[model samples]
Target chain A: MADPFLLAATALVALALGLGLARFLRGPRALDRVVAFDGLTIVSVAAIALAGLVTGRAIYLDVALVYALLSFLGVIVAARYLEGGEQ
Target chain B: MSGVLDILGGLLMVGGAAFLALGGLGLWRMPDTYTRIQAGTKATTLGTLLTLAGIGMIEPGWALKLALIVLFLMFTNPLSSQVMARAAHRAGVPLTPQSRGDALADDEGRAAE
Candidate 1:
């Protein structure tokens, strides 16, 4: 890419994604996996946003917005499922 | 002026990405679920916000949409974290062995008093 800063940013976000994935795989508890998943999705959203910036395309940001909303909903629903009737 | 903006935006994006990496490190290294949640939620939220802001500076015309994403994230990120934490607490996900008391559990005890 022409932008070294953004290129580095992409690498860092990719590193984050890898770490989150490792945690998701190594989790001893369901909650840990959920937390890892939450972090992973957020990183993915950031990645999408970075892609938008790098490509100079506003449309990617729209995709990012929808992704963020859906991930939030997914996390909430998963948490609620795990909470069961204890709430 | 545009050059300066580009430089500043690049710096912000780099900083934000660094924060995102730190959050992932925390997720990998933290001993327990709650601490991991704290690390994952707070750091990534800030990182995402800073990143989006940098993108906005680089492309001013996209500011409104970027702001919408930022606002939505600010509202939902912590809320989802809170929900997850509460769920984990109720589901009996134990804390780290060396950790202090849980205020949420204490609140429950006090409520019964």
Candidate 2:
């Protein structure tokens, strides 16, 4: 049986995603958009974790870890690019 | 042992999520981009960390991997938020009139001359 706790967590994360979505739509600048993007990555991780918790699968955790690493590196690269080419 | 930890982790995760929601609220309510950035950065970081920890608790065998995600978020979340704020300033986004300092001027981030 799926744990109710996991389901609840997922619901909360979904709500967070909705908030991020609204922010993205009206962000005042490129950075604000990026911040909203970062928020999306966080939401993705939360969704996966909540699913893993509910499903009792260790595999999803690994997926979440990979997702975190990629998104973090991606944001950094994009941020660096915004800094106007290497110093 | 596991049961107690799981419960604790869930509560923490829930609390953290609530904090994130609060941050989102701040983002919506705060006037100006600068204040919104501060809200997003702080709230999301704490919320994500707690959510990661809850995952670790739930998936005991994969705790190390989940922990790594948490650490990565700790590092990258703040750095990116800071960078975004800096970029905002460089691009000439107007700061709130009463902002205490040139926050985007890299004053805090500036290394000693």
Docking level of model 1: medium
Q: Report the C-alpha displacement of residue B99, candidate 2, in angstroms.
A: 2.2
Highest-scoring model, lDDT: 1
Worst 10 residues of 2 chain B by lDDT: B104-113
Model 1 chain A: weakest 10-residue lDDT segment is: A78-87
lDDT of 1 by residue, B44-96 (tens): 98998888788777888988998999899899988999999988887877788
| TM-scores for candidates 1 onward, in order | 0.92, 0.81
Steric clash pairs (candidate 1): none
Kindly provide the TM-score of model 2 when superposed on the true structure, using C-alpha atoms. Answer: 0.81
Evaluate model 1 with DockQ and give the value.
0.70
Off by over 4 Å in 1: A85-87, B106-113
Candidate 1 residue lDDT tens string, A33-83: 889999998888889988887777889988999998998899999899988
Give the C-alpha miss distance for residue B66 in model 2, angstroms: 1.2
Fnat: each model in turn: 0.81, 0.39
